[model samples]
Target: MPRFLREYFNRNGVGLGSVMLGLVLFWTIGLIILPQLSMLDFSFRPNLPPPEIGGPKDLYTLENYKYLIFGPEGGSQDYNAVDLKVFYRTLIAAVLVTLFNLMLCYPIAYYLAQTNGNHIRILALMLIIPYWINEILRAFALRIIFGESGVLNNLLVGAGVFDTPFDFIRNDIALYAGLGYAYILLMIFPIYNVIESLDRNQIEAARDMGASWTRIHRRVVIPYAKPGISSGCTMVFMLSAGALAAPQILGGPSSLWFTQLIYQQFNDNSDWPQGAAYAVVLLVTCILLVLALMRVFKVNMGDIGK
Candidate 1:
């Protein structure tokens, strides 16, 4: 064999070596190179009908991006005001849902990690059982419970909590509830994995020193589990930001999400250029958030993954 091949096989056995090398090449070409080229190509394409003989003649125009990001004030066609509103609302909702999930999941994850016996088993089951059901089914089940004539409103009315059924569908509360339910497992798992790998001796020592539960949790546990928290928050935020089904079925007409707008642009309106632009914007936002979190928490991505 050649010197490089001999060294490569020495470092990595031939079978595993070829697979790893292929994967790296595949990722580099397909993910990094192709997508960047496609994004650059699509971003400058026109919103109008395609040319007959050539690819876009105006390949450097900013009209598609400008129209999508900011509404066209002087366009002949009807502008998408609803799209803009949905985009902002989705951004805000995702942030709120991520915060809510972090608050709710962290404590439970900590308990699951620290506790033992039946309690741990029960908590593990609680986290895992929901995954057995399809996500869309879960959303639909929530709809059945929260719908106008659903069990919740019926029971509320029966108990005289309210004279009539409250409008739960298409409301912000429903959106938040649906989002929280869908992402709760995702939030818990990362934190649980991180906390499980933590050294318990330090926490025991803190307690032995007569530290209060709150003080120990604040000073020791949180700092140690920061990687897990960062991973969980990043996963939940990204998923919630792109969520379409739960928000669509539960959020109703008024509660249109940004993903819905993107879907409409791509599928309903056949506006691929605008959809790509929206996707690019969402991608940029997610990248910025990941970078910001890495900076703020000083947690390496490798540690979180581990």
Candidate 2:
């Protein structure tokens, strides 16, 4: 067992620790790893009818993967421009959501973590109360808020800020906003948890050394919050990238999400291998991005566990 597990066992004793350990193993292996392995296997295999699943006709091939590039039958084109465009756009949108949440939440996290006040509880409640609702409900609520005649636009128009309601949904504003909002908590709490652990004396010492607020944060706060930052970024990015509901609910006519394509392969097209292939592509890309972010943050998996 790892040190954490050993420590956990010591604290909880054999019986309770064994139950927790079993649950963790079951969730990790039975739920996550097995499904992923199944999908990966399906991705490599050709789509076949139920009777032909294990028949001689059912041989593994790269056709499903190639289908993403060239369609069902290989065409003599460089690539499928539309699908690839959507794929790249989805990635960009996910990144934007991650960055948006980070920028918006970091200041709030700092305030909540560092400030001392009787109002902190109320402020924290105000921040958190909204997220008590389901993610889908929140997305729909955002749709209502950002629609042309919706709450925000209506408020602006009634206040004479605009002569007419803005086309936020049609303009793709709602999609981005909803994506960012959906994952905001993921960014905020991780940052808060890490920043809360930082010693106040270090910050005070830096201030006494005549460090400006910006310089103090740059040299002291952000560096200390690296592990939390990494965890938040990773969770936000992965969830944003894999999001289906937000995109489906708030997407504009031009806003085609990559997951929609994967959904279509499984449902509309009924091509399991093709769907698995698209899913595998997305999964691999997300893993690569996580690795890249970890590298950029100079954070190891062990640090993120902290």
Candidate 3:
């Protein structure tokens, strides 16, 4: 730690180093730590009605947490099966979306990195411009595309792919597709940046040795780009898991995301304690998933941003 600090100070100089350190500390404590701590406190408190708000002191209980594991009253043998299922489903869907983005974007990223010309800049602009639009607008656009009278169904009908419009919105397809589209750039840029840094000679040498394209990517490219892969997947998974707008917009009545439930508790139901507990659970789960990914990919904590 001392050596690190010494090196940091030496490289950045004392004035800049101190400023950086101070900003980091402030960000860590003020933004991250304090908010979580306050949420923890709120999670323990009971949800009181407006009429009974000031009537009680220290209305802390485990009711909110219990409501998660067990049912409403906290002592039921059966858990809140609906909430539990939706929570896990949301996590699983987020992972699937991350993997989907990785698969969909990897080739595009590789193409952009490997190719040379003004076309690369054009292609990059096209990728970035969509994301500059509001997320809600993007989601609404997707909603329109997947709606019964939308472009996809019309195309499918025109091509004789389906006799009638398929209910894409009623299912999870639109939700997943919207999320993947929303974060495609996040996945693409990282992998592209890393792959561009790789030595082209390595790929050529492997190709000269009669290595297949698949083999070259597996052996010479993927290992080198693991850090970028990890970073991209981490960002996509975290964002997808926490996403509310896209899901709410694209998901049907049957589709239930954990964030929607949290929103309901905080807004519609006015159960702040329960909402806080759910938020904390989500935050913890995301942290655990991130740690697991870092462990699996052998990435350092500091490498995610790069």
Native-to-model Cα distance after best TM-score fit, residue 32 in candidate 1, in Å: 7.1
Order of models, best lDDT first: 3, 2, 1
1 versus 3: better TM-score goes to: 3
RMSD of 1: 3.2
TM-score of each: 0.88, 0.92, 0.91
Off by more than 4 A, model 2: 1-14, 74-76
lDDT of 1 by residue, 118-203 (tens): 97898788778987999889888999999899989999999999998988885667778989989888888888887887789989
**Each candidate's clash count:** 0, 0, 0
**Candidate 2 at residue 95, lDDT?**
87
Ranking by TM-score: 2, 3, 1
Winning model by lDDT:
3
Off by over 4 Å in 3: 1-21, 49-60, 74-77
Residues 1-306, candidate 3: write the lDDT tens digits: 699999999999999999999999999999999998989998998887678765665487888888987868644568898899999999999999999999999999899998889999999999888888999999999988999999999999999999999988998789999999989988998999999998899999999999999999999999888878888999899999999999999998897999999999999998888999999999899899889878877898777777
| lDDT of model 1, residue 123 | 70
lDDT winner between 2 and 3, please give it. 3
- Looking at candidate 3, the ten consecutive residues that score lowest on lDDT are 49-58
